[model samples]
Target: MIPVTRRIAIDERELSETFVRASGPGGQNVNKVSTAVELRFDVAGSPNLPEEVRQRLARLAGRRLTLDGVLVLRADRFRTQERNREDALERLLGLIREAAVPPPPPRKATKPTRSSQIKRVDEKKRRGNVKGLRRGRIDHD
Candidate 1:
């Protein structure tokens, strides 16, 4: 089980992992050994997550989430499969933990103060008057 928070624990069985060859740093060993870890979790079907967390997780996953609602994380930073696997699991846990937090309340609408409105108008008028002064006065016949 992976504990995300005091109230949320994800079952280990929910995670699926696959090994694939990684592209960098291993040299000859890279061609022979599969070091990359692909971790997949079904966010939409997980019984461990609350509805709110599930929704947030989906949004947070973005392009990482498949059409089937599975969250895919690829870990190839490490040259060893074990480290890559751990990295993938850690990333998944971090994402779930982030989703567990509640969103902030919406901001209330506010109107400008009467004094501020007056100040804005005054500034506009002052600017216009300064520009108007740049014009040459016309002589009356």
Candidate 2:
């Protein structure tokens, strides 16, 4: 089991991994070896995730998530398959941990203080006066 949080633990069997060829850093092995790891987690079907967490995970997954609600992560930053696999797993866990955090409460609508509003108007009037001074004087002979 992979413990995401004190309340959330994910079963290892819930995850699926696929190995594919990665294009980077491994001169000869890059072409022959499948070093990239593709990790998939079914957020929709998982019994471990709460409904709210599942929804947040889907939102956070964005394009990486399939229409069927599976989260996909591709890791090819490393040359070795083991490193790539671990990288993918770490990324998946990080995403889950992020999703687990509750969103901050919505900000309440607030009116500007009376003094601030007066100050803003005063500044605008002052700016207008300064610009008005910059204008050339017209003669009335």
Q: Which predicted model would earn the best lDDT? A: 1
Candidate 2 TM-score, C-alpha based:
0.77
Against the reference, the lDDT scores of all candidates come to: 0.92, 0.91
Clashing pairs in 1: none
lDDT string for model 2 (70-131, tens) is 99999999888899889999899899999999999999999999999999998887777777
TM-score, candidate 1, is 0.77
The weakest ten consecutive residues by lDDT in model 1 span 132-141
Candidate 1, residues 13-119, lDDT tens digits: the string is 99999999998677799999999999999999999999999999999999999999999999999988999999999999999999999999999999999999999
Worst 10 residues of 2 by lDDT: 132-141
